[model samples]
Target: MDISIREGILTPDTFAGLRAACGMPELETALVGRAIESSLFTLSAVNGSRTVGMVRVVGDGAFVFLIYDLLVVPLWRRRGIGSRLVEEAVSRAKLFVPPGRAVVVSLFSAEGREGFYSRLGFTELPAAGLGAGMQCFYL
Candidate 1:
């Protein structure tokens, strides 16, 4: 099978479908479109005309980059598509850093998926001289 990765070509429908295929709840179409348009970068993997995977980078475009919504359809998991998406996002993040300075590229890994990101060099926070990462969601 051939997979092509394209940047900044995701539609809300495709994004929602990919999210659903990955067992995530549906998001509002307007919100998804707004998020995509506002993201630092967005990448989608296409198998012909269907979107099989997607990943996005969100941040202030210099100091911090957070990998968000990394998802690959169930049928495409275990095939490295997700890894490739992350690699592309990381590459973009590096470009945002200015010379003689550093930028943080981080993500909140889905539970039980630490190995996936760790293999790509992401470390668990608060474990290597860093503070614990925290978040709060309003329900």
Candidate 2:
């Protein structure tokens, strides 16, 4: 399959569609648009005008980068499209800061997908002095 990774081209509707295709719960498109606008970077994986996958990176450019909403439609999974999206996003994240500065790239992987991120050079939390990741969702 011919897939092209486009930078900063994600639309809220496209994002909602991808989420639905991946079996994730629906989100309000207005909220999604706001989130997309706030992202430091966004990438869309397109196969002939259809968005098959996408990722959003958010955080202060110098200190942290969160890889959010990494998704590839079911039909495109395991074909390296997801991996390429992540690698490319991280590569761009690294450039956000000046030389010799380090930034933490973090992501909350989907259930059972820890090994995927691990193989991509992400260390499991609570290892090597890092604590397990935590989160708090609002009502």
lDDT of 2 by residue, 33-102 (tens): 9999999989999999799999999998888899999999999999999999999998999899887787
Q: Give the root-mean-square deviation of each candidate in angstroms.
A: 1.4, 0.9
Q: Which segments of candidate 1 are over 4 A away from where they belong?
A: 99-101
lDDT of 1 by residue, 44-128 (tens): 9999988899999999997779999999999998999999999989887888887657668999988999988999989987796
Residue 43, candidate 2: alpha-carbon lDDT:
98
Q: What lDDT score is found at residue 13 in candidate 2?
A: 92
Model 2 misplacement above 4 A: none
Worst 10 residues of 2 by lDDT: 96-105
- For each candidate in the order shown, give its overall lDDT on alpha carbons: 0.90, 0.93
- Model 1: how far residue 70 lies from native, Å: 0.4
Q: What is the TM-score of each candidate against the true structure?
A: 0.93, 0.96
lDDT of 1 at 61: 96
Candidate 1: give the clashing pairs: none
